[model samples]
Target chain A: MITFGKGNLRVPKWSKRVFMVAAGCSPFRKYFPEYKLEELVMMGYKMMLEDNNLKLSPLEIKDSIQFAVYGQFADHFQDQLLCEAKIHDYLGLDPLYNVGIKTGGATGGTSILMGAQAIASGYANCCLVAGWERMDEVDTRTGNFYISTAACKDFETRMGRIYSSYYAPMANRFAWAYGLSDQVRAKIAIKNRHYATMNPNAQQPGDHTEEEVLSSRMSAYPLRFLECCAMTAGSASVLLCDEEMAYKLSDHPVEVFICGGSHTLRVADRRPMDIPLLPNEKPGMYDEFLKKNPRWPGFESFLAARFAAYLIYRMAGIKEPIEELDLVELHDAFTISDVQTYGDIGLRPYGQEVDYVESGDAYYGGKCPSNLSGGLLGTMHAVGATGIWQAAEVFWQLQNRYDYIHGDPKWWKRAGKKKPKNWKSLQVKDPKQGLWVSHAGVGSHVTVGILRKAW
Target chain B: MAKPAYEKAITTKYIGTPLKLHDEKPAWVIESPRAMTHIHTYGLLTPFFEGLTKGKLMATKCVNPKCPQGSTWLPPRADCPDCYERMKWVKVPSVGTIYSFTLVDYAGIGIEMKTPYWQIDVAIKGVDTIFKGYLESGKPEIGMKVKAKFRTEKPTHTILDVCWVPA
Candidate 1:
C-alpha cells in the first residue's frame, strides 16, 4: 500500500476530495426504450454520463478525455492499433505511452484501479476511465452470440448452453454438493434488486419480493429473467489525479487508493477442446468421462460467489470471514451470481451466505449493504466495464459523495425521515479493514478480484 | 451411421460400468497462431484462423516432440511448457458423435444463445478426440454419430468450422 503526504501537492481540501479521479459510466436505455429492460438500462447509463459531465460521441470521446479509458469494441477497441489511434485522437492521450484498455467482466473496476494506480504512482496528474456498450444495435440473439464467445464456446455452448449455462453447471454442482436451495438463490435476487431500488443508476429497480424472484420466468431452472442482469448501453467514467493536482482541479474530491488486485481461471476455462463432461482419462470410453466430470450439482450462483470471495480475501489480506466488510459490489451478472459470489468470497460459510440476504445484512441500510450502487443486476452489464463500475461505487462510498444522481441508494423506505447515506464506513467501527469484490465470467472463463480500503 | 465402437452384448450390466476414455491413438492437431510463441490469444487469432472459413477445426500441438503430455493440449499450444519445445501445427477432425450434452437456458453477460437445444460433446475421428460443439440437428445421446458443419458467415479464419451433425 502507498500513501501520499498532503505536502506532495496541495490545492484545497475540496481538491483533496478527488486528488485523483477515476471512471465515468454511461448506462443507455434511450436507444432501446421499448423493453422495460432497455429503459432501466438506459437510465443507469444516463445517470453515469450525467454524473460525470461527459458529453462526447463514443468515437470522439474514446480516449481523449482526462484519464482516458474505454470499453471493448470488436471492430474498434478489439483492434489494438485502431483503439490506440482513437485514444490519441479523442482523448489526445497516447495509450502506448499512458493509455490502454482493461476489458472483461469487472473491467470497470479494474480500469478505475488502473487509473487510480497511475495517479497514486504520480504517473499522471489526471486520468479518466469510461465504459459503455449498446445492445440496441443488434437483435438480442445476435448480440448474445457475440457475448457467448467470452465463455468456452465449443464446450459450454455446444453442450446446449451459452455462458449462462456455464453457471448452471456450477450451480448444479453447488446444489448437489452443498445442498443449497433454489429459494436461497432467489433471496440473492431479491436482495440485489432491493438494494438496486436504492440505486438510481441501476437499470432495473424494484423491491423484488422473494416469491416474485423465485417464481419469475425461469431463464434456466435456477435462474429467472429477474435473476439475470439486463443488457444495457451505458458508459461510466472516473478521473484520477495526484492530491495536489486534484486539489487544484476540483472541489469535493475523493481520495482514491487501491489495496490490491488478483485474478484466477476456473476448470473448464483451462481446457476448451475435449473439455470432457467428465475428466477421467479412459480411452474409448464415454462413461468414464461422465463419472469423472459429474454434472456439478447445485446452484452455480452460490458457487461463483464463494469462489470469488475466496480469491478476494486471499488478495486483500483479510484473514477474518469476509462478511466483516461494510459494503460489497459483486458482478451479480445474474441474481444467482450474487449468492455464489457471497459464498465464494467467504462472506458466509458455504450454503449459508444466502441467509445473509434474508437477514437484510446484504441489503441497503443493512449490514454490508451490497451493490448499493445497484450492481450489474440493476446496472447494465457492459462486459468488462461492470467490475470497474463497482470500484467507482466503492470509491464514492468511501468519499461520502452519495448526493449525486449516481449516488442514489438502490432502495429507500418511503416513510423514512431522511434518505440513507450512499456511503457506509466500517472504518469508524472496525478501523482496520474494508473490502470490495468483483467478478467476470466469459463463457467458461471466470476471474475474480478483491480490493480493500487503504488504512 | 457407423456402428458404434461398442455393441451392447448379452451382459447388459457391463454397459452400466464406467470405462476410462483417452485421446485416440493419433492426437488431434490444429493450426497454431505463428505470431504467438505460446497458445494464441483467441481474439487475436480469430482473424487468421481458417476454422471459421474452411469449415474445419483447428488447434495447436505441443512443440516438444519429447513431451509426454503433448497430445493432451487442447485449443493447441505453440510450445510444450513442460519440456520447453516449439509446437507443430495440426488439424482436428470435423466429424464425431455426441459423447454427452447439456442445455443452457440462462447465459452470462454478453451471451445470446437461447435455451432448449443441445450442447453436445462430439468425437472427431481424424483428429480422433472429443471436442465440444453445437449439434444443430438431432438430440444428444451417447453413440449418436455426428459430423461437423459450418455456419453461414464462415470467416476464412475461425474455429467455428463444422458444427456437430447426426451422421
Candidate 2:
C-alpha cells in the first residue's frame, strides 16, 4: 500500500486492491425502539470483528483499527455533527481520525469510499465504515419532514412536493416514452416481493400479485404505496484494509474499488433536456419530446445515476458492463427508479428496460441477476444504511457465502417454481466481478463501485 | 439452485406498546408548541425574491461575446456558469409551457396544499430555466401554455408568492 509522508506523498493508482475483509448488519426492521444508535453501531462492529476470524488478541485487533467513519442523515432525531465523536467514545477505541457523512441515501456508499481512501492514502492501515438510521422513532408526518430535507427547501418542499411527487414525473415520462403500462410497473413490485420472501432480513416478505400491486393505494399518481420502499431502522457496516492486511485477517476477502461519483444540478436550475434533439427533426418535435420526455439539467435524478454508472464503467476499464460484471446492486427506492437505473447503467438502451424486464434477463439465473438480497424495495430502506448494505451484500456474493431463504411454496410455484439462484453460487462456478450503485437527494448525488473476488 | 438450511428465525422486540393517541389529537402531533422558521436566502439570490414581491419575473443573461455559453438563466445567478463573468438581470415574460407536472395526492408537514393539487415545472418562453409552481385552475397537461399569477394582495417574499394559471 502507498504510504503518505511529508515528501513521499504521491497520487495512488487505482490498481491498488483495497480489500473488504469483514462486514455485518443488524436485522432490518420497520421499527426499533429497544436499541439506541450506539448500541446498533457497536452490534455491527462486534459482528464484523467476529466475522473477520482474526487470530490476534482483542488489543491487537483494536490497534489495527486506525480510524472509523460514520454515515447518517436527519440529525433532528439524533446527535447532529458530534455523532462520529460520540460513536468513537462508545466504541472505546484509541484516539484516531473519525468523521460523519450525510448524503441522503448515498451516505453509506460515500462512507465506504471514504474508508477506502483512508487506507489507500496510507493514512490508516484499516478503517471501519458504519451507517444507521432510526426512522421508526418519528411518526409518518415527522419522517416525511425529515426526508424532505434532502430536496430543494426553497422550491420543492416550499411548494408542498415530497420525494414521491418528485419521482412521479420521471416515472410518468419514462412510461409515456417507452410505452410501458401499469402492469409493467406492478411486475417490478411483484418481482421484488418474491425475492424479499427469501431474505429473512426483509421488512416485507411474501408474494405480491401484479393485480395487487396495481390496485394498491396511490401515494403519487404513478407511485403507489406498494411501489415504494418501507421505512426501516437498521445499521450496516464493512471493514476495509490493505491487501496484505486483509489476507492476514480473513480467508475470504472481497477486493473493492471505487470507480467514481457525480452530483447533478439543483432542481430549479435544471431544464428538461441537457442535450437538445437533432436539428434534422421536424419543427416542434423537440418541444414535443421535451413534453413527453422528462429530462433534467446536469444529470437530473434519473440521469445522475446513469452518468455515475457510465463514469464508473469508464474508470474501471469496463467496456461491456452487462457482460463484464456478474451482478449489480442498484438503489431501488422506487420500482421505476430501479427500472430506469437498469437502462442508465448501460444494461439496456434508454426506453428499452421494459424489454429487459420482460425477457427475464434481470431475474435470478437470467443474464444478469440484480438485487438478489431483496433490494431496497423488498428489504427495508433505512436511508443512510441502504447503500452500505448493498456493498456488504456484494462482498458476500463475491466470497460465495451468501444465503437465500425460500418464500411461500404456493407463490414459488406461481413464479414458475424456479428457485432464485444466488449469484455467489454462480461466482463459485465461474468467478468474476460485481457492481454496487446508489444515489441520494432526488438523484442529485450518485456513487458507484466495482468489486472482484480475490482468489 | 439448492435451498440453504434455514437458520433460527430472527425477530425484533418492541420496548413498549405501540404508541396510541390519548385524545382526539393525531398520533404525530407534538404536545409542545414548536416554532416553524423560514430559511433566509441571501447574496446573489436576494434580487430574485425582490422581483417576485414586485410582481415581476427576473432572469440573468451573459452578454460577453467571448463566453461559450451566453444563454439566459432563470432563478438568476451572479456569474455565468461557463465563462465565470458577471450576468445582468433582465425582466422576462411570465408565459411558459408545462415541461412536466405531478398531482400531489397526500399532504404532510409544512404543506398547506389540499389533496389532488397540481404542481407544474414550467419552461419559460424566453428564459432557459425551468421554474416550479402550483397551478391555479384546470388540470395539468404537458406542453400546456401557462402564465404567472403573482400574489398581489399579500406577498410572502418567497417562491410561493407566484402561482401559475392556464393561459
lDDT of every model, 2 decimals? 0.50, 0.71
User: Model 1: how far is B147 from its true place, Å?
Assistant: 15
Best candidate, lDDT: 2
Clashing pairs for model 2 are A198-A405, A272-A295
List the candidates' TM-scores in order: 0.60, 0.84
Fnat per candidate: 0.22, 0.56
lDDT per residue for candidate 1 within A133-212, as digits (tens), equals 55544445545555555555433443432455555444544555456687877767766666665554556766777788
How much does candidate 2 score in TM-score? 0.84
DockQ of each: 0.10, 0.26
- Docking model 1 quality class: incorrect
Worst 10 residues of 1 chain A by lDDT: A272-281
Q: What are the runs in model 2 whose C-alpha is more than 4 Å off?
A: A1-12, A52-59, A271-303, A404-431, B1-39
What range of 10 consecutive residues in model 1 chain B has the weakest lDDT sum?
A: B27-36
Quick one: best TM-score, which candidate?
Answer: 2
Error of 2 at A57 (Å): 6.1
